[model samples]
Target: NQTKMFDEKKLDINDEKYSSFGAVLTDDNNFYFTSARNTARKTYGANEQPYLDMYMATYNADGSFSEPTPISDINTKWHDGPAAVTADGNTMYFSGESFKESKQFERDKDNNLKLGQIYLFKATKTDGKWGNIQPLPLNDKTYSTGNPAISADGKTLYFVSNRPGGQGGNDIWKVEVKGNNTYGEPQNLGDKVNTPGNDNFPYLTTEGKLYFSSDGRKGFGALDIFVIDLAKGTEAKNVGLPVNSGQDDFAFSFNDSKEIGFFSSNRTGVDQLYSATPICGVEAIVMVRDANTGKPLASAKVAILDERNNVIETRTADTNGKVTYSVDCDRAYTIQASMSGYENNSFPIAKTHGGEVNVMADLRPIVEIVKEIEVVLNDIFFEFDKSNITKEAAFELDKLVEAMNNNPEMVIMVKAHTDNRGSAQYNMNLSNKRAKATVQYVISKGIA
Candidate 1:
């Protein structure tokens, strides 16, 4: 997995009362998200939903956010924000289509002036109100710059922009966040993180890992969340499901104090918020196949066994001959696969040390063809004139029992011959006893 699975929980859960799309949890017990639920706001012509407004709520101790209230001072007639509050929770940077005095209105592609062309706006929080808002210097009439994410130290600012010198549509760009609201020159994030597709909503973590959404790279859906570790390298890896769905999933952020994460997805038909936590366990993908033919054995039952060799659970293989088991890390386990007409096979899985891994089980087919017409058996020897079956003679008798079981309709003739040292009557009597003992032995082995 380029990314691990997220133990996700949907906060909205089919309650589409609002269309919320981003999450920003701050150290000051503040939670921020963008939504179009405010009926008082004017509707934008693009989606016909109420204009997006910045909403603030309390991050509860129970890992739930309080009822969100729009930041009325910051919310304007046009779209307000999907914001990033700094580590100190004092300075905030957000994408807004509202600032009126910042150069009137922005022009569209047809040179039409409208309430579009989002730009990064910096705001300061004091006494529970957001004010002193000013657009970043990088915003221009020729291009659009928005979706701001700042580093923990507030020195670097990462954002999405279709501004000049980009890979194509929207590329992630970063700038230095100097003191006094002044900034450094913006630079593109290069082709590695920025693809020709639409990449937006960048979220920076304290560990220098940047989580963002993009349609440029191959993903489960249109906009899938991806992360790139600045310390590791710049290969933006997709954060696999259930954080990523086959629909739009974006704007991933973490709350380090609570050890919880949050993201937004339209997988429920409407954009909604989802809380995510890292799944801590091992994922074993068991692939069943034929031992000789190397073909997938679908419908095969795969069982996970504990250390005591008792089956914990069993799962049937899908069309791809694959089934997965979630087990504890650094633990030994056994997997057994079985299918009709194929011998059951079991394989020991070594300790995974906590990661996703692939395991294989090959089943040999049980050949049922009987090619022999006449069944033959070697002579069975016994101790001197004894009626009891000896260990050596029992070995040959077991083969006869197996043959009788293999061919249920075939009958066996027991002819126990002995030496000429005894009388004819005594030899006959001895042979009868030996034959009876052999028959009893076969019956003891549950053979009819």
Candidate 2:
């Protein structure tokens, strides 16, 4: 059935003792996930729970996963799981509990572990073999950073951290890669993407859509995955169940199509894997223009809304003076076009098909003239004191020709005038000559 895409499947390796959390897909069709499986056997294992370790499992094209293998180089005795892989599969970013010897003194005011830190590692292909891992430079002593979502260009990084001076809890932060291997200081994404409640596990799509899990708002339970349109403001919306059952559905990753993604969830009794399929449809196109002059306006802004006045898209007209957009069909779209120097134009358009449809709208400029003033210059003039008609005079005469061509019935009086530096009679003779020269230029340019 089509609904098979939303079906949840229990991962085979999970036993009663271990917990599985964040998971990601590698380029070679192998899956990488964080697990606390075998690490529970070590002495001083803290609470005897599994310390997170990185594991890889081969995935068949038809959607079956083989047995997982532990990645030895980066995993350690302390907790190290919750991982994100870059698109090229050459780099990884993940969170880990610190293995510092002075761990007892690393507790915060609430007596929680303060030594956890995020680490960046690079993997290079050498002589047909994957090379050893190298750590990134930004690891600091104070704040713990993890859960990275690298932008499609691999230039910007988004991660989660509970460092001091945040709104509260673990806030989402980002850092832009300044150079080939250097990154700038991390900055909080602010109240839009962060909350007083814990916000973590950021997954960005190739199209710049951000998906993350949070328990901040009312949800199924624990951490529920929410989708936020990064282009529009940072408003978040719960993805809803059965994808987000009353359990933690965090650490999500998606393929390029965005139609499918994998998330670790405890909804089915254990923190296993679940897949999701997105509902698909074509979007409608809306175009706005200036109705009076038929001229496209660059500064015109458009707001498309539904019957409930909910904004579907808010876009500004391009330099061609048109705003092109797509929305689902059969919905009532309230379109409002406004510019600072023009009156606002508001109307409603009902889309029927999911194809190209043009909406012609024109806005009038603010200046009002009681009577139309027409200035017709039929003659050309010399520049400064020369008697020859310059190119500027020819340009003005071309406009007169254009007006006559556009309005066949319009008649204009061609008045030729000249400065009185010469005798009045001489000036009149010069003006007549300039007027004849202007008409000859227009005719030569094929302006009827």
Query: What is the TM-score of each predicted model, taking all chains together?
Result: 0.63, 0.59
Best by TM-score: 1
Model 2 alpha-carbon drift over 4 Å, by segment: 1-17, 43-47, 100-135, 179-181, 282-448
- Estimate the overall C-alpha local distance difference test score of candidate 1: 0.81
Model 1 regions more than 4 Å off: 1-4, 12-15, 102-115, 281-448
Candidate 1 structure quality by residue, lDDT tens digits, 86-204:
89898889888735555645556586656447788899989977899888787776667888998989999999888878899999999998878789998898877889998889888
RMSD of each: 12.3, 15.2
lDDT of each: 0.81, 0.67
Candidate 2 structure quality by residue, lDDT tens digits, 88-149? 77766666554432342245657564544555454554553444555455555566667778
lDDT of 2: 0.67
Clashing residue pairs found in predicted model 1: none
Model 2 misses residue 346 by how many Å? 15
